[model samples]
Structures are given as C-alpha cells and as structure tokens.
Target: MMTMHPQTPDILPRVAFVATGGTIAGTMTEDSKTSWAYSSAQRSGESLVMGIPGLLRRAQWHFEQPYSIGSQNLELGHMLQLRAVLLRLLESPEIDSIIVTHGTDTMEDMLYFLHLTVPSHALGKPVLFTGSMLPSDHEQADGPGNISGAFEFLIQCLSTNADVSGHSAMPFGLCMQGLFTPAHRVEKQSTAGLDAFDGPYSVLANTQWLLSRNALEMSEDSGVQGQFASLFDPTATRHPLFEAMEVPVVFCTPGNGPLRQLTDLLNRKPASVVVAAPGHGNIPEACVPVLRRLLLNGVSVVRASRVIAGGVEQGGEFDALDAFRQAPVQGGNAVFSEAGGLNLSKCVMYERLRVLAHSLSV
Candidate 1:
C-alpha cells in the first residue's frame, strides 16, 4: 500500500458531521445482523464520525448531534431545532461543509422541509445527508462506506461549485450506496438492502449510471428543486407557520370504511388534509360528499396516490361520484402538484409549505 504521502492538516475540509441517530448509530441487543432487532440512538455523534479518518482521509470531521432519536419518533419540533442548528453551522466560518447522519425513514421529509425553509445565505456551503441500512458494528456494515462516499461527495461539490454562484439554492443531496439523489427526488425504497435509498440510480430512474465512478458530477442535474425549492422565504418575513403548522394525513380506503375517520377529521378541522387516494389519487364515490363538506367547511384537501410509481395528475377526467385527480378545489386551498411527481410524504411537506406561503401572502 502506498501510504507514503501524509495529508496536510490545513488542506482538509472542515465538516460538521451532525448525527441525528439512525441505524448508523444503532447496536443490536443480541449478536445479530437483523436491522429491526437493534436499538437506535445508542451511539454518540463523535463516536459515529471519528471512525471516518481512516476511510476517507479527506475531511476533518467535527461531531454534533442535535438530539438522539429514531426517525419514526421524529417530530416537527425536532426538525425546527435541527433547522436552527444547521443554519447556525452552515453560516459558521469554521465549517466548510456538512454531512448529517440521519434516520433513513424521515430523512427525506427533513430534507424536503429544509429545502423549503433554509435561507439562501446558508445554501452556499455543501450539505449532504446520509445513513445506513445496517448498524455501525455489523460485520457487513455499510455505514462506513456510505459515510466515506458522502464525504467524497461534499469534496466533489466543493471542488466543482467553489466558484459557482447566483443560484437561489445550492446543491443538497442524499447519498446512499453510491447513489446521490437530489432533495426533491430521493426516496427510501428497500427495508433490508445494503443500499437502501434510490433516486437517480433507482431501477426505475429515467437515466442510467454505473455507480462505479463520479456520482457528484451527475448531481448538477439534480440540484435545486425547481419550483418546490422555496416557500416562506426567510428573507421576506418570519411567519410563525414555518415552525408551528401541522398537516394531517387521511388515507382513502375501500367503500365506507374511511367515513368514520373522515368524519372525525372533519370535526378536527385541520388547516390541510393530505389524502392517500386509491389508484391515481381517486377519492371513492361514497366519500365525495363528506370531502365536499370538509372543503366547504374551509379544510384544504390535497390528493396523493397510494401507488408507489405514478403520481396523481391534475385535470384528469373522473367518472360520476369520484372526486377528480390532484387538482385544487373550487374555492379552497387545495394544493395541486404542478407535475405528477409527489408521493404521500412529499405531498405532506408540500401542503405545509403551500399553507405557509398562503399565510405569508395574506
């Protein structure tokens, strides 16, 4: 091994590697590789980040954990705190880049939320998020490799976009198993695969790449989430909804079964409701009347499909009794996905931002 040349300390990128625990910080109670059998949030951020010096040899990693908890228990309050920490770190003169180890389950949600809320001033530095399918100590652990690859990704961004400027938002990507996907597109696909996330490298992704060399170069195409990138512009105003608003999800099931929940939700009268519709976001004929009543009662409704692939398209015709596709209601705040690209979780965040924007304008 040619381990001759030593790395210059000053040349290394200063990375604030924030660990908000997930399987990467997890440890199995018994001697097992089973992902579900493990306890998450067991390790500290320093313990998780310090091991990277041997693999990457590039960045000087600093450890910071906003808090330790599984993604399932992730709440809006935690994310507001995280947004605060990330904005502080990115704006800091000490740090040159950032790599966050977050739970894969709600990682995309946080990314999408941050994509909307993070100020443009903080977008200059490289921000990359990553986590693992297996625990840190597992024999076939992928956290080390994922972390190494993620660090390399930031280096590539710093190298490429050092002089690039004037864009409203800089590149932020999710790295898993060698695939680097943009914030707007990344989604968790598998529960058990070593490489558990996919976007540009997904099997169903439009373009194909070998994942062997150069994923960061492909990231330029994945940069800045077009129209969905900004809402509630931090520079313009500080609307309280950014941190406090809540959008509840309602799933449309077969027949009259969902009526009870819909009735309860109607009584709750939330700001917005994101419905997981059957087929292409189709509201069942039976529930149409109640949905109308909800809409008339000033509860906004946004439709998303339960199906994995194709999203709900607007202006699509529907037969009698069934509510139309992902279109805004006649006189309410139903937010439509400009394109048929939003999934259920995305629709939730999108609706939140839409409500925030609507509130800011008023």
Candidate 2:
C-alpha cells in the first residue's frame, strides 16, 4: 500500500493505469492539429499522462501496456490478454483502483466482457474506463480532461470508502468528459462529439467544471443484476478466455436466404451460433427451420439484439421454434434460462455465446 503524507492526505490511494491502445493514445503529424486526421496507438500510456501537466504528482500510479491496437481491430486474443492484466492488478493489495484509457469504439463491449468474467471478490476496488473522441495532441483534445476526471473520481472513492450497501456494489465505472457512467449502461452515441456517451440509466457523477475543487456525488443504484452471472465457473483459477480461444464461432445478422450459409457455418462444428437480429431479437421467418435443424444437432443457439438496450422477449418467434433449454455448454442455459434480461447487445451476446461454447459440458 502507498503511504499518505501528513502534509498531503489527499494523495493516499495507489492506482494502476492500464492502456489498451485507442484514440486517447493517438498522435498526428507535427503540422496537423485536428483530431479527425491522426494515427492511433502512437503514444504510450506514460506519454499520455505526461501530456497532462501535474498528473504524475497526483497519485502513486503505475502504467502497463498489454497491447496497442485500434479498438476496431481488437480480437479475442487481445481481450483475453487485457483480462489477464486486470486479474493481476485487481489481486494486488497495493492497488486501490484501475483506470483504462481506451478508444471509444468498443468500450461498451470491453466493459460488458469484464463485468461478466471478473469475479466479485477480485473487483473490490473500482475499475473505471475512459477515452477520447479527439486525439491526444489535438488542439481541443478531450483525453486530458477525461483522465483528470477519472483520477479525481478515484481519489474521492478511496478517501471516502465508497461502499453504500455495506458492500462494494459498483466495482467498475466509466468516466467521460464530465459524467461518470456505470459501465454496463454506457453507449457511444456519436463518432466525433466531445460528449459522445449516453445511458438510458442514471449518471453516476456530473462533475462539470471545477476539476480540482468539486466533490464527487453518488446516484441511485441502477439495480443491474449480474444477469449473465452463471456464464463462468467461479471456482476456476484460470481466466475463461483460455477455453474461449479454442472455440470457432460465427456471428451473423438475419437476412433473406435459403439458410445454406448457416449450414456451412455449423459444418465446422462450432461451439455456438449467435444471431444478431432486429427489434427485440426477431429474425426472418425463413431462417427458422434451418436454425431449428442446427439447434437439434447439438449446436448452441443464442438470440441477441442489435438495439442498444432492452433485451429480447421470450414468447414471440422463440415459442414457435420451441428453442427453450439451457445452453449445451457448461455455464449457462442460454435463452432457456429467462426472458426480458436475455435481450443482450450484439457484441455482448456474441461474447456470452463464446463463453457458452467453450464451457465444459456439465
């Protein structure tokens, strides 16, 4: 644990700032000044902090880069590597919290993955995520301000011991320009706007200006269940990705066709097939027979929605197919488990399906 100086009691927490390469770490040509025209993953996390004056003196923080790639190109291997780093950090008694500086493109997906896989005991301290719409060196770049917001939020949480229910309820947070959002509820609504995040949920903190002086405030608990809680075997010591890496999977959006393509995908003997459909997880009626054939063949089938929020409803098309049952893989029963909560985002549903495919048969 980092010691606190009596003269500066404020500098009491120890933090780990993990970087996974994003627009927040981007840079441009010496003459270029606009955020739109720049190369990404050019700057290290250390360099990003240095760009923000007085950041180094804020806390006893350390930096580590697992990999540097654009979020658009992020793969399963990269996510697993990041999960490994987070596990190591969260287990450290010396670290009070973590702040991930990433690109905004896949931040929600990344957060959802972490939320599902990371154990509750390991996530005792807050693990927050932040990024910039603009590059690090843009004249009006948003990286520094976002980082500052995260740092300040951590300071407040550590100083006050932010546990409302006598337990650490919110182990992860997403801090943007001036708003601190809950990870599962965060969404990137715009491509280039400074205020690009929106949540149908409540804001955790709204620290507008007064970066150095304002106190952090808490909002009502969103009551988000660890809905995908059964997806992982809690007793397992190794990260879930170890098995997930071996699974060959397919993610597709429903369309007009004879479903020959779906048959081709199943021929590979994949662990599961994820259908990203429209309007509460409904797919074309033509695709149903093929899907039913695949489901009957012991292949796992998952229904996920493309909508930002509100999961799928149970009795609609799913009832007609009689697709109710636990996922064949170890952890979850998949769509058969429940309705309403199953309507997951396309990316999140794909990840859950991956976990299910890799899961050991019970």
Off by over 4 Å in 2: 1-11, 29-35, 164-171, 206-258, 307-309, 323-358
Candidate number achieving the greatest TM-score relative to the actual structure:
1
- Which residue pairs collide in model 2, if any? 311-343, 312-343, 326-333, 327-333
State the weakest 10-residue window (summed lDDT) of model 1. Answer: 204-213
**Which residue segments of model 1 deviate by more than 4 Å?**
1-10, 31-36, 53-57, 159-162, 166-170, 201-244, 319-339
Relative to the true structure, how large is the alpha-carbon lDDT of every model? 0.66, 0.63
Give the TM-score of each candidate: 0.80, 0.77
Residue 147, candidate 2: C-alpha displacement in angstroms? 0.2
Tens-digit lDDT string for candidate 2 (242-332): 4453222233454443366666755764555656566666766767777666666655566655565676656565554554465442433
Candidate 2: how many backbone clashes?
Answer: 4
Which candidate comes out best when scored by lDDT? 1
